[model samples]
Target: MAQLRYQSRRFWGGLVGVALVLGGSGCQPQQTSTETSPSPTASPQPGQTDPEPPVANPELAVYWVAYKDQEQLVLEPTKLPLDNLENATSEEQLVVAFKRLLEGPANTDKTNAIPEKTQLNSLKLQEDGIRIDLSREFTTGGGTKSMQARLGQVVYTASSLNPKEAIWISIDGEPLEVLSGDGLIVSQPMTRKEFDDNFSL
Candidate 1:
C-alpha cells in the first residue's frame, strides 16, 4: 500500500511542474523596443532671393489745349512731370507744353487742332513775352477755320504759363505777318485776348 501511494504523489508533482513551465514560456514578450528618424529639408542657395518691385515716377502740373464741341478752344491742364518737364527751365517748359498739345487730347471728349507734322524750331523767352518759331508745316494746308484753331491752340497753351504776357508766332524763324487762311494781318507779340477775340466760347 505505501509503495502505491509514493508513485501517485510523484506523478501529480511532475504534471504541475510541466504546466508552470509552459505557462511562463507562453507569457514572454516578443519585441524589445522601436525608433525612427525624420527626413532632411533643402535650404535656399546663394543669389536665390525674391525679385523686387518697380519704382514710380515723380509728377507736376502744366497746361495743354483741346477743342470743345468742335468749335471753341479749351484749356486742358494736365501733369507734365513724367516727361521730365517738371524741373525744366521756363523755355523748356513751354516746349514740353507744346509737345503735350501736339500729342493731342488725352480725354476722349476733346480734340486737337494743331497740325501733327508741325515742329517747334526755337523758343526765346523775353522779359515781357515769348517768341516761338515753328516748322513750315505750321502754315501748310489748313484753311481759315483750321488755321484759326491751330493758332488758338498755340496762343492758349503758351499764354497760360504767363497769363500777363504775350507770345509771338513765326514760321521757320520768319514773322507770321499774315494768316494766309483768312488774310488776317497778325501783329507781333500776339496776346490771348487777341486770339480770344477771333475764336473762343
Candidate 2:
C-alpha cells in the first residue's frame, strides 16, 4: 500500500511540472516590431524672376493758330504725337514735328493756317539754317490774312528747335519770292523773331 501511494503522487507531480512550463511560456509579453514606414516628401517648385521696365514715348511742340478773346489771330502751341522715337536723331524729330504741323490742330478753338491740300516735299538741315520745300498747293489759295497765317505757321514750326535759326522757304523746288494773289513779298532765310516782327497773325 505505501509503494502504490508514492507512485500516484509522483505521476501527478510530473503532469503539474509540464503544465507550469507551458503556462509560463504562453504568459510572456509579445515583442514589438522595430521596422518603420517611409515619410512623405514635398515636390520642388520653379524660381521667380523680376519684371521688365516700361518704354518711354518721345514728344515735341508744334504751332497752331488761335485767337485771344476774339480780338485777333495768334500763334498757339500744340503738343506733337507721343511716338516711340527714343533713338531718333534731332533731324528726324524736326521732320516729325513739321509733319505734325501740316496735319492741323485737334482743338476746334484753334485754326490750322496751312492748306489741307498742301504737302511737305522735303526738309533738310543746313549749316546756315533749315531748308523746307512744300507742294505748289501752299500758295494756291487764301486771301491776304490766310497768306500771312500760313507763312507764320511755317516760320514758327521750322525754327521750333532753334528759334534763332533761319528758315529758307521753297514752293515746288522754287524759292518763294511772292506768295498768293496778294503778292506778299517773302524774304528768304526767315527767323521766328523776324516773322513776329514783320508778319501779323
Candidate 3:
C-alpha cells in the first residue's frame, strides 16, 4: 500500500509539473510581425477637372486705308487678334503685323494701299530705327496718289510700336529713292510724323 501511495504521488507531481510548464510557456508574450502592406493610392473623382487654358490679350494694331467719301480717303487702324501671336517675340509680332497689313482690310469700304503681289523680303529692328525690305512688286503699278497712300500705309504700320522711330524702306535689296513713274521721291529713314507733315493720301 505504501508503495502504491508513493507511486501515486509521483504520478500526480509529474502531471502537475507538465501542466505548469505548458501554462508558464503560454503566459509569455507572443511575437508579432513588424511588416505591413502598403495602402492603395486615391483616384480622382469623376467631376474633378484640371486647370484652364490661358486667355489671349489684344495689343497689336494694323493700319488700313478707308474711304471717307468719294473725294476723301483716310488711314485707319485695325486691331490684330493676339491669339495668332502665341509665344512670339517683339520682332515676330512686328512681322505678323506687317503681314496682316499686306493682307488688306476685311471691310468692303476699307482698302489696303500695299500692292497685292508685293512680298515681304526681310525686316530688321535696329537700335536707331527699323528696316523693311520688300519685293520689286512694291514699286510697281501706282499713280502719284497711290504711291503716297502706300507710303503712308507702310510708315504708319511700321511705327505702330513706336511712332517716334524712323523707318528705312528698301525694294528688292536696294534703298528706295524714287517711287514710280509719277516721280514721288521718298526720303530714307522716314518717321510717321515726317510722313504726316510732308504728304497727304
Please report the candidate that would top lDDT against the real structure.
Answer: 3
Better of 1 and 2 by lDDT: 2
- Model 3, span 142-180: residue lDDT tens: 688888898988888887777777999999899999898
Off by over 4 Å in 3: 1-59
Pairs with backbone N, CA or C atoms under 3 Å apart (clashes), candidate 1: none
Clashing pairs in 3: none
The TM-score, computed over Cα atoms with residue i paired to residue i, of candidate 3 is: 0.68
lDDT of 1 by residue, 69-175 (tens): 87665666675554565467877777777776777767876566567788888878888689889988888776676677677777766766666468888899789
lDDT value, candidate 1, whole model: 0.71
Instruction: Write down the worst ten-residue block by lDDT for model 1.
Output: 55-64
RMSD of each: 19.2, 21.1, 17.7
lDDT ranking, best first: 3, 2, 1
Query: Relative to the unseen true structure, what is the C-alpha lDDT of residue 107 in candidate 2, on a scale of 0 to 100?
Result: 83
Q: Taking the tens digit of each residue's C-alpha lDDT, what string does model 2 give over 1-201?
A: 999999999999999998999888987788899867644433333573444568553336688888988988988877655466557766787789888888888889988878898899999988989899999989977788889988988887777667677999999999999998777899998998888888886
Q: Which ten residues in a row have the lowest lDDT in candidate 2?
A: 37-46
Please list the C-alpha lDDT of all candidates, in the order they appear: 0.71, 0.82, 0.84
